[model samples]
Target: MCYFLGAMPLQCVSGIFVLYSLCLLSFSPHCDGGNILVYPVDGSHWINMKILLQELHTRGHNISVIRSSTSWYIPEESPLYTSITIEMDEDVEDFFDVFLQEHLRAQRDGTSLLTFFKLTKGFLSMIARAHLLWSDATNQILNNKTLVKSLKDSQYDLVLVDPAIAPGVVLAKHLKLPLVLNVRWITSGEGHFVLAPSPLSYIPVPGSGSTDNMSFFQRVKNMFFYSLVLFQEKFLVGPIYDAMCDKYIEGGCNIVSLLQEADIWLFRSDFVFDFPRPTMPNAVYIGGFQCKPAQPLPADLEDFVQSAGEHGVIIMSLGTLVNTLPKEVTEEIASVFAKMPQKVIWKHKGEQPSTLGNNTLIVDWMPQKDLLGHPQIKVFVAHGGTNGVQEAIYHGVPVLGIPLFFDQYDNLLRLQERGAAKIIHLADVNGDTFEEGIKEVLYKDSYRQNMHRLSRLHKDQPLAPMDKAVFWVEYVIRNKGAAQLRTGAYKMPWYSYHSLDVLLFLISSTTLIFFSIIVMVRYLCYRRRNTKPKQS
Candidate 1:
């Protein structure tokens, strides 16, 4: 931007420029909302993203969303954002539904190393397919000259993307716009490993299911799990993005670097919910941003919860993805809930179980946050999704986690490490185990106390997490992206990033110097010996 608003003297330009920046800052806290182009991952990712959009809309930000035509969770029409739907051959939810059944069966089969490896393999397959679908969708957008031109013409200030899928990252780079990521998982793994210093010695990799303090073998397990993440990225998922970049994006980009190059990482993690770990300045923690003070529940639901009286209620939801468990497992859980004095509300969407309890209410959906914060609520039976876990922490409700798949166990472990949750392995899930877990979280005072302690810590933040997220998002728009916050390490190749090349050079130089000193000393000794013999 030029200092002069019009044709003016260069002498006055400097003073005007300084004043303009100060003026911009003075008024930028609230603007007619910056133009935000959102590329959101479907499914539960949309749930939290919708919250951000609602807030942005309230501030008068114009939002346009890129969605798949067959998106299961993202509806075609919404007042929050206009939709740009891309047609696709397949629905991701279709496979995910199939995968859920297989994944549950695989988990219930056993807990052996081989079984876990198989689970990893299955997960990689799903990730690879998902990436392919997103890449193809991105390619369609890039190839369409009209759409591409219009996207540019819209003059969006920045791209707000969930980096779990790299299509958005690739599209952001193609547009050459500032980027803000609503991210926890990227294409490879957790966002920290890509952008910050995550020494595996202490930081447990996702899917490893280890706590921050790990045993020797647990660390090895963590390392192995990390390798799987890398392998998935490099071999399984990376090539899809690479081909897209090669064809569509200028120059060439990889998903990992694109994620690292983002102007802001609105990380959905809090130190209270997560272990203490290194973070980047650009990585703003907006954990529990979706959480708020409980709103009034529906009259009928309130009546049900109030009927629990002193025993309080328990709520179970396995998220939108996992609609129902296998029949036998479902019956077992239903049976156990039937015997409990505390009432249970389960979010299930299928045939009612034969053993369903009189004291339980089954719903296709629930006001989960509202229920969690209710005074009559005592326990959360969760699948350990990050959103649910953070909400549980926000409401100070202890969890009985029956983690079904993908980072759920790890999320629960974070709570369990602090004694706020009890975990039961899926393979070990039965009536006895389910009942025992629920009882421990419900009856034990420590579980409630610890969770309450965590809730207090979470609530003690100076700025509401959502406000902090929005402020940084606006910060990117006002500054046109302050690249100074991002470190240059991500731009380096692995050899340079880790200093491996420097180490090799130093070793070779030291070896050469030592050899030369030895040779010089030997030559002097030989000359002295020869001269002494000649003199004699």
Candidate 2:
């Protein structure tokens, strides 16, 4: 048995090494360079992290990881990762696997809602008692005497922090190593951009650029929606993330501060999925990092698709979250497909929608990328997920996006404006609208042409997103800190960046004063014009 004590990989016994040497005269590949430590939000992230780690190792860099026990609903019986094997404490490993198994099973059965709530409550509890929790178990993990001692012993060079589980940032700060943060979404900077209401009417959206063409009443409704989102963030999300990171992760252990103290920032987006990049210097859009189509579809499925012929095919999926929208919403979407001229292939996790007809093949799951690559795939109807959007662009497939929440709406709008997709409101969505949207996508040569152009533009780039991410990551390690790219804007308050309320106040005050002046001038003019008024 090999023993992993802290960070060192050691032989359990001298006699075992001797025995192994006697049995085989093979040597392990020589590992080199500074060690890298990774922290991600479990499951596929773990898998992706391991893949990167192995690639780094192949280039001769030593690596160690501190992954969370949570699996985020991926099945437990499945292997942790395909590329590398990890050695963890047996008890910890067992607990993690068992937790994943139970949670994943519940997720499959649609009973994970209560479990999710309970976990959310615990997270809230930890946040509420952050000071205590910080000084105790959670914070200790980051600055654990054992882990730090290991890193110091190994002389690890860089630390990668996943903003999702960012405790490692505190650890990085404590150790004073180069830090890198992996931003998953528009979570930072007050959460108002896409999540909040900013004169961005969300509910009764008529089309992609509806705001630009909206009536005054429509604008008012949009502003109302935007304001409600801001209220939610101000009261809820902002405080929660702060409480989680500030008190518990960093302050107690000095790990997160180290992470925030990191020299480089990596924003994962290829710009294919998002439009008009955020104005952060170190932030690079590395989305579509996993854009490659993994494998070909099964022969039987290929034949079925090929048999469909000139009618073409429509692929329908709501991505992972809201995979099961309300039955009404599903029926509306299905009815639209029923009336469509194309054959539809719907990737639904629930029971087959009753409205689906002979032309529609309602399956529990489909090879998303593979289906997109198919010549018969005419259009995509998706929930405007980052991954889905990227895939559609990669395969030159046009989309009908029905965004549900978060960045999905923004992504859909961006694609719609680019003429590669169309957006429909989740609330007022129906069969007629869906059918009309599909017809437009099919008849509109611009959407297909634009998607093809985008695909070419993406491919013509100097480097792949993954390559860029890896390069920048290495640059940080080689240069100690990528401070040249850091900007002064990071130091400013959130209110200053977006002067929305300030502008509103100025407009309101100016209108009030202008009206007052106009009223006074009119009264004076009337009195001056009539001598009888002056006498009165």
Candidate 3:
């Protein structure tokens, strides 16, 4: 090395040193990058997971994504990560869209127990089918000696997976690699309830429609919602995963146990948007990790936004699940947007609404992050998914939420409570209500101001959410696993964790002592009365 440096010019040597330093700046603390094997859920979950992969790839980490052959959002080919395609029984994405449409239609008619039952049945069937396919795929992969040997040879540092599904958790365990969960939802409900201290009185269960502050009735409702989650897991989801584990893993396992075994949870939630709740040390918050500064818009879209001028533009998207609203709902929404002064860019995927206004531009897909970040954007008409809500907070854009299904109401309720958004329930979404909701958000300066405050709070963090996420992932990699940070709470049985057995024992002892004292006092009183009467 000294001989070569002597042969080289001093300027050339300095230039080489400078270039090497520049490369080091892009990497994490550890110089040599770690290999990350990812198993991501499809739809919006995949979108965020893809962002993480891009960042990791930039930092010189090797990434491999295990995806189902029938996945909709996760492409078979991507520069971000090499794909390990698992053969699926059928397409799972379409099931969600169909179920969403049916749910909307039921809500339009009127919400009743029958509607709830029907909608719930569809939702459960979707979950059951998706898990069945994924479990089968995982079983196939595990049983195939060639594929099993190949994955073993890869020697991944960690398995970063979205725990919304069971395959990744099981796969990570089967591979005996350190597990890191990129999660908001697990199989049944929000991930935190499973991993941290979640009090039913305060921590609102997803789909409960309860807030952090709860009334007696609301708390009761939250418990019921929480019970539903438990029921779904115990009956609907858990058995499938357990059956798969029994086939492949030693000493038959379950999904919850595997998830609990995860080393680090890169949770996609922030206290700024999410209610302040108890969180574990290993669970790192990365709420808006996927958000970035706005990019230049396409020429036509730019022209549309610029045409709005001072009125500014409104953008609406109902996440990836809802492709099209019911016909009546669509016409009502289109009519409402038509009457507004602001130009509207809607990510609609149905037949052209007859009532669509000239001011509204409909598209199949949108640059949601860029549009939210755009200065010309005024109001975000959203379905209140976590991604949209976080992006809205990141961009300081007030939301006019029309929550359709699945934690959407709970998501919007947070913003509504913060006075940054107005929620219009799916059943009540007509032209008049939609127009009034939009006008309220558009005219109210407080909505904008409140959101700006949230934006400031969310941005005031010491490290960017994405950087924090990458750091935790690398922390796990660098240290083999983060066992110290992970709490042993999950290992405790429900009775032990809640201290119910101790309570039962204490109660039993107290009752026994009280009764014994009463009996002894009665006996003493009787003896005293009898002896005194005889002496007299």
Taking the tens digit of each residue's C-alpha lDDT, what string does model 2 give over 1-536?
33553544554466667888976755532223656766554533454455455556666666665533333433333233221112222223334444433433433344354855553344333333422322233454643567557667777678876654444555566667788766553222221143223334333322123424457787775565455444433554445445545654445422222333557666656655554324455666566665675467899777777777888888888764444666776787787777766777887776667887787787777888889988888889888876788888888899888775445676787778778888876645667777778789889899999888888877677778777777777778778877777654444456765777688899999999999999999999898888564444
Descending-lDDT candidate ranking: 1, 3, 2
Off by over 4 Å in 1: 1-30, 532-536
What is candidate 1's lDDT per residue for 1-536, written digit by digit as tens? 55445766675777788899999999766555789999999989999899999999998899999999898888879999999999887888888878888889988898887987777777889889988988887788999999999999999999999999979888989999999999998998898998889999999998888888899999999999888878988999889988988887778887887888899999999999899998888989999999999999999999999999999899999987888988889999999999999999999988899999899999999999999989999999999999999999999999999999888999999999999999998889999999888898888899999999999999998999999988898888888886999998877888998899999999999999999999999999999988885545
The best candidate by lDDT is 1
Better of 1 and 2 by TM-score: 1
lDDT of 2: 0.61
Worst 10 residues of 3 by lDDT: 24-33
Model 1 residue 87 distance off true place after TM-score fit, in angstroms: 0.4
Ten contiguous residues with the weakest lDDT in model 2: 81-90
lDDT (10s digit) by residue, model 3, range 282-320: 888999998888899999888989999999999999888
Question: What do the candidate models score in CA lDDT, each in turn?
Answer: 0.91, 0.61, 0.89
Better of 2 and 3 by TM-score: 3
